[model samples]
Target chain A: MTDEQRLYSIWVYLQAEPLFWLTLTIGAYLVGDFCYRRSNLFPLFNPVALSIIIVSGVLLIFDIQYERYFEGAKFIHFLLGPATVSLAIPIYQKWALIKSNAMPIISAVLLGSVFAILITYLLALAFSLEREIVLSLLPRSVTAPIAMGISELIGGIPSLTAIITIITGIIGAAFGTFTLDLLRVKKMSARGFGIGLASHGIGTARAMSRDKTAGVFAAVAMGLSGVVTALIVPLIIFLLKI
Target chain B: MLESIFLIFLFQLVGEMIQKFFELTIPGPVIGLVLLLVALLLFGKYSTSVKTRLEKGLTTTAEYLLGHLPLLFVPIGVGVVMHISFLENRLLAVLFVIFSATVLSIGFTAFVMEKLQNLGNQNDG
Candidate 1:
């Protein structure tokens, strides 16, 4: 048989298993949640973190390609856009509180992004890492889609960006409030805003777990900070020529 | 009733237009949000029924979403499937970035507010 025939056979096999990764993705989600609930340590057991690790392991063990996995899992992926859009409803509902705190929230997101990017970049330089690593590191605080775009535009690897993004979210989920309390941040609004700005979705989840007020601020901050960081981080990188 | 429907339509249209044009990087609903906030501020007075309906509709959706927010990461998780090689080479550096940024943001925000609150306490003392 010629090479053409072999390629056709592989394509045929791929077409047959459209829902494979979808099942795996859902399985990973459920199992990850189970593991998180079982584990006493909330941070270590973060469902998002665990699911990614488990699914990656499963894919690797079975030698499944990402594109093929994504083909089946893309239904889950498709929801992210709408979910992100759905975040606006809360922001609208909380208009009065948000309006009162708009200036402060904006200030926090800007300061938080600068702090996140600068510390990551400076520390990476201190450790003598290459430029690509630094670029990928820069957008770790943003949500995955926005971070991926920022990383790609400034020449960072998207895969590295994805991993770092997850790590950021998990870390934010686990320790955000602990650190906030250590510093004695009593205001739920500020705490939520800071977490949402710094950690995106995971941070927002953690915030929501705290209170309705935290959740509202988290939704606003998560959405708003995405806009701020995506715009500002690239411009800064361009200007600094880093 | 008619006014509320009109509000949704107007807000949604403006939201989509902002998204299409400014690429504000913000979600359209958020843009609609700013518009809503502006109207609220400008009107400075909302009837009880209108407020109740809008708030009720918005809050219900928010509550539902808040429940499953963690599940949304599944898509980005799939991104890992695509870029395994890059993940292999730069695990530490990526880890460092995540750990440091997460810790730093939480630390910095908390620390600054603590200082301000302390200053306020000192003044009262």
Candidate 2:
């Protein structure tokens, strides 16, 4: 048989199985991890970002619809819940430091959430973007689970919010460290907190790659921002009547 | 490993129960975290041997999971593929706004945290 026929047969066999995307997801992540390690763990060599690019590129190349790919991908998606729960470990490990800095952490996260909303609102209005887009944009700094819920409450598209949130995370993770260094922000917790506050899960993941103290603080900051953003967004929106 | 994974899921289950009961907006995992923290605290304060083992088990499992935390987010990142059409129109504006807001928020968070922490230090001094 010709190469064309061989390619078609291989695609047909693999595409028929629901496990394909799951395999692809894990495989992509492994490849990404390998590249990241080989690259000396470059900040931009984020496994999530790389795997998404690789898997999505494959789906696009194969002409497979996202819904079909999602069949197997959902397994990894479901793990997000447990992984989120696992964050309690770092928080638990650094409980003493967090406890000591409780007041500063709470205050900084509160202000950070507001700052995120405030800037997002300003920029969204400046661009005269759609109200739906603006609403979705508001929760971009928060985690997926909370942002998705809040998106529905505030008349935004939850899926769109998820997209924006992830991109926000990816971008923040890529540039946040450099930005912090540029600003000469020498405080370890502050650096971690900034990343977490702005980018959520993706940023926290990046912080974890750097140092333990940074990772612990980023975890707390990400966790705190989730709560503060969930609670305060509505109150601020109500008070400002925005 | 099995024991630790069990503890993680156990807290998550309790978290889900509390979430449904309260109709809370908070993620179940975050609530689970609080429960786990409380348990850790009670155990750390009152018991030694049992606490050590449980803590050891849970921390190991949690560390392992969190260590590769980025892997868990890949599916969600890939889900972005589903929304390209909807976002295609305002893509530039959306990107610009998110980029600016992210930078500004990080800067502001770090600045405010530094000042507040220094204030706390000054008071202690």
DockQ of each: 0.35, 0.60
The alpha-carbon RMSD values of the candidates against the true structure, listed in the order shown, are 6.1, 2.6
| TM-scores for every candidate against the unseen true structure | 0.76, 0.92
Per-model TM-score of chain B: 0.62, 0.89
Number of the top candidate by DockQ? 2
Give the number of the best model, judged by lDDT: 2
Candidate 2 lDDT, A29-143, residue by residue in tens: 9999898889876768867778889998998887888888877788877776777777777777777877778889989998899989989999999999988899888988988
Best-fitting candidate, measured by TM-score? 2
Candidate 1 structure quality by residue, lDDT tens digits, A91-191: 55566666666556666667777887888888878777788788888888877767887888889977678777877887888778777777777777667
**Docking outcome class, model 2:** medium
Candidate 1: tens digits of C-alpha lDDT, residues B24-102 = 5455655665676566555446668767676566556546655677776766755654464575666666576667768
- Clash pairs, candidate 2, are none
